[model samples]
Target: MSEIPSTDEALANLSMPLLDAMMTQRAIRRVKPDPVDDAIVVKCIELALRAPTGSNGQNWEFIVVKDQRVKDQLGKRYRQPWSIYGALGRRQAANDASMLKILKAVEWQVEHFSEIPVLVIPCLRGGTRVPYVPTPFVGETSYFGSIYPSVQNLLLAARAMGLGASLITMPLWNVTSARKILGLPLSVTPICVVPLGWPRGRYGPTTRKPVQEVVHLDQYGNRGLTP
Candidate 1:
């Protein structure tokens, strides 16, 4: 979509087939700095509410950030880590075309971070660890695992609405700083940030390895169905 979609238009767009949305939903890091409709954003989060959470805890919170000052803070944090990692990634991907493409896109996002229209910070309320107590492996997994499904739903909804979006965590590398910047209390742990805007590029089918290559049959080493 070349222009910012109307609320009604965006809502109507959400009926896109599940498989179609999944197939084309690549991380869209390059986006225009246009205002997105609040209704659309809420609808996406509403659909996200449908995803199951661990133990039905549903302890998820979505912080929609549009303030430039807040984005600038997050952007500063993002650049801090990206300065080192981005250099390393560039060197590692020097001979890889596909990887270089992704790196370039990321570089654009880092540079224009403050301009992106909306950022959705998915957070979890409650802690797996008590003071002086060690959280078990399952406790850690269940805690973080609770919010990702909803994040996936949010991403798919963005795709269906033709809104460019990408999931990122580097911006929140310093949890304390992120919490302070977003005014988040200790009980709420921000999982990741999903920056949303209208696409500067178009969404199309993504490249991936064939299913057989990654799918193991019954055992860890069994690559095919006929193990």
Candidate 2:
């Protein structure tokens, strides 16, 4: 019989892959034909469920779209905002070269969204209608604070499992059509759609503004703490 790995060895092996996953995550729109099995999909959801929720409510739900017909319907609805967004970007790009590149990349993503293998919808257990009256910022933050963590956890878990996914909200702007197509109840509001599948290529390290530039001391604009 093969020798079993010691506990420390097993933990060390697991840590390397987790670190690699965190370092390599990217918003991958293009995917290969390799199908993600139902079991793996379920496992990812299980991992997401472990995420902390407000008051331990665990009020998040996930809808997995595998049917081609439903995917096609979503793809059509997705085109509406995408077109408007593209137009706006094009208008702005005339004055800014960086804007031109960003818009072009977004256009490419929209064109291929429907071809993804699985579309995962993250839904929250709250009515869509928001009160017109002013509400405390804390209340608004508290409400969403419950579910967004779960969403991020799900994406990270997907990356660790060798699957690539991207969070998209273009279709959500047309809430009425999206609700109708998904048969979402009045109490449920769709937050985002994550397209997931095996990636076509390896993701490189993501670049962002250095922490020193963004992080401040006790007060805003205090740059003394910056390294």
Candidate 3:
């Protein structure tokens, strides 16, 4: 009979490649001219499918967009809100150089989304009928809990394969038109659209709120163990 290894032993045997991949992942917007092959995209989709779902329902679907005409239409539709977002970001910048730099990157993304090699739409199987206000209980399982983890897994897998991707939701905000263009059924709702390609830049460390400020103890507001 096979024996199980200790937790420490398992930790010691962890794959360094995967660890590096996880540590180095970043949301890259600018990409190279080299196109991602369809076979590779399919492999990434296969990896995304392996993500666990609530009750193992696996009700996630991926729509790959490669046609330039479709991309152009999406870009045109997306620009309306993108312009508003850019204006808001500029106002928030307040002439701060660093903030302006960040906004510039965002602006570049908005302008060139259609030029990206591949656009992937992650869709949920069922629709939710809830009011604007929060509800006591919605359903057996929430769509976010089932599908978002899969999207994260997809991005991580893409990083490991030397590809880069970013999650974009501006297009999905126009849910009606977006669904019509993609031929998505009424039951299926688009969650996020990811643009994928070979990155033009290198990955960098991510900044976040300190662990001490975020983590909580037994109570909701109580600070957790000190770092």
Candidate 4:
């Protein structure tokens, strides 16, 4: 295990090159239970605020959870859905080593979730005046479109600071229950949960398909300039 850095050392790591951080960022599920500095957690959210929102509405809220009881409640929510999904996943990936590896990591995370140090829940607060009212498709897009960019920013910041973090929505499967658990008003929608702590493993380069394989020129299926 890597030695835990002083808060100053961890904050200074934010100067790491953006490309390096982006390329190496991955869902780090396993982490130590050591308490993270309040300043470090705040800094990650501060950077997250830099991301763009739909119409610049900035209708975002972040709930930083450190309480063990709250974490246990969220863990229960996670397990409720995962029990069924995990069984399905194992059966589906029975013959695929790569997929089985990913499932195993998720299993570990689900089992140890409450023991993780922090849970940052990002939320959205504005849209329809009436809560839970159905909106048109475009309205729907604009409504939920606001939170993801900020989430990417948060993930990138976590990567720069060498914090282990992963974005998961499973714990939020039951919105009504989640709202009650977090004491959120109906206007605020909890988008996803980001679990954070010092890593049990290290961050490294990720494998992905070549850009050319997925990129198209001008329109779909138009491989312009490709010989």
Instruction: Give the whole-model CA lDDT for all candidates, comma-separated.
Output: 0.95, 0.75, 0.76, 0.93
Question: Candidate 3 lDDT, tens digit per residue, 1-227?
Answer: 11223334423333337667677777887765456777667767887888888789888899999889888878877788988988988998877987787677767777887788898888988755665855445453475778888888778767766666887788777989988889989889888888887777766666666888888889889985787
Candidate 1: tens digits of C-alpha lDDT, residues 1-227: 47777889999999999999999999999999989989989998999999999999999999999999999999999999999999999999999999999999999999999999999999999989988988899999999889999999999999999999999999999999999999999999999999999999899999998777788888887876742
Off by over 4 Å in 3: 1-16, 95-98, 130-141
- Superposed by TM-score, candidate 2 places the C-alpha of residue 71 at a distance from the truth, in angstroms, of 1.1
lDDT top scorer: 1
Which regions of candidate 2 fall more than 4 Å away from where they truly are? Answer: 1-16, 90-102, 127-133
TM-score of each model, in listed order = 0.97, 0.84, 0.84, 0.95
In model 3, the clashing pairs are: none
Per-residue lDDT of 130 in model 2: 65
**Model 4 vs. true fold: TM:** 0.95
Ranking by TM-score: 1, 4, 3, 2
* Candidate 2 lDDT (Cα, 0 to 1): 0.75
- Give the lowest summed-lDDT range of ten residues in model 1: 218-227
